[model samples]
Target: MSKVVLITGASSGIGKSIAHYLIEKGYIVYGTSRNPREKVVNGINFVALDVTKTETIQQAVKEIAEKEGKIDFLINNAGMGITGPIEETPDDEIKRIFDTNYFGVIKVIKAVLPIMRKNNGGFIINITSIAGYMGLPFRGIYSATKGALELTTEAFRMELKDFNIKMTNIAPGDFATNIAAGRYHSPIIKNSPYEKKYKSTLDLMDKHVDKGKDPLIMAEKVYAVMQEKNPTIHYKVGEFIQKFSIALKHILPDKVYEKMLMKHYKL
Candidate 1:
């Protein structure tokens, strides 16, 4: 029997693309969506799951485990983004974003831990972003959430070692996806002190996203990771320039990195 795989936010974008890729590779893939539809891609199964809801996550895992008797790999790719000046973004908006991007991930991992533990081995892949390595202008909150997940996944990797389970962080720079489809914007941005700058910066941000590489590249990277007996703890996917940017952030001085980011976004 093929190894069973579960992916969240599989209705579209990276999640959906990866699901199709894995299906083509003959993995028994179970993809989740907040509101699942009858849409089918090859043999990938869509399960109704809202990462933020513990009950739904529990049920989805239960259904999969019951039928497959094992979950060999799990990809937590469900997340949303928020944009605007950090000061103008309301506390509630930040909370909602974290609830979906950070806390929701935690909830799903917790729900599946027991099954993986019982099985004695499994792979958990968390979808992070290049922004996780550094805060971006106007998208600071979104950065914070991914940054939190990055650190969290690192800790999870260390702890899951004893169980023979593995955790990896897939940090993609920017890919053409509808990830921004459900992105939230601070209502007060229009009247804020940074209003004009925020608008221009956001426009530039959208332009970059529009020209981003196909998400299938990331999906192929994901496939490569799945073939590994022991994948790297973190894999960065994107254009050479974008991946180089991540490397530069590590070696460059704080001031230098800030200048680079500012120049890229024309801030």
Candidate 2:
């Protein structure tokens, strides 16, 4: 029997790409969207699930477990993006992002854990971002959420070790996707303190996404990780510079790395 895999935020973008690739590779794949109008897409079973809603998370997992007997793998790819100067961004918006990106992931994992424990083994892969490794200009909230998730996964892995459940975080750099469209951008206040710099950084961020690598690169990386017996706690998939920036942060002094980022963002 083929393994059963569940992926969140599968309606489009990176989640969609992963669903398609895994299904083609012979895994029984179920992809979730907040509201899926279709029953299936390109062989992926589509289910309705909103990470922000606990009831929906439970129902979706229950339905899958009832049908498949066990969920062999889980890909927590459901997350939203936000960009704005820290002082200018709304508190509600920050909470909203954390609710979806961080809390939502934990909810889904909780719903699936019992099923995985019963079956004696399972794997979980979280779709974090390279931005999480550092505090990027105008994208601080987004970075914090992913960074928190990364640390949580480290602790989660140790807790699940005795249960034979494995967990890992995959941080992708810029990818050509509709994420830019979905992101919440705090309005640029004219003549405000951060107005000029915020506008410039926002434009630069979009350009990077426009020229980003194909989403399939992430999908390929996901598939490769699933094939491992003892996967590492973290994996990064992106261009040389994007991946290297994370390394530079560790190797360079605090001010030096800060200067590099300020230079990159033209702050």
TM-score of each: 0.96, 0.99
Query: Which candidate's lDDT is highest?
Result: 2
Error of 2 at 129 (Å): 0.5
lDDT of 1: 0.89
Q: Report residue 197 deviation for candidate 1 (angstroms).
A: 1.0
Error of 2 at 110 (Å): 0.5
Q: Report clashes for each candidate as comma-separated counts.
A: 0, 0
Q: lDDT of each prediction vs. the true structure?
A: 0.89, 0.96
lDDT of 2 by residue, 1-267 (tens): 999999999989999999999988999999999888889878999889999999999999999999999999999999999999999899999999999999999999999999999999999999999999999999999999999999999999999999999999999999999999999999999999999999999999999999999999999999999999999998999999999999999999999999999999998
lDDT of 2: 0.96
Off by over 4 Å in 1: 39-41, 188-191
Worst 10 residues of 1 by lDDT: 185-194
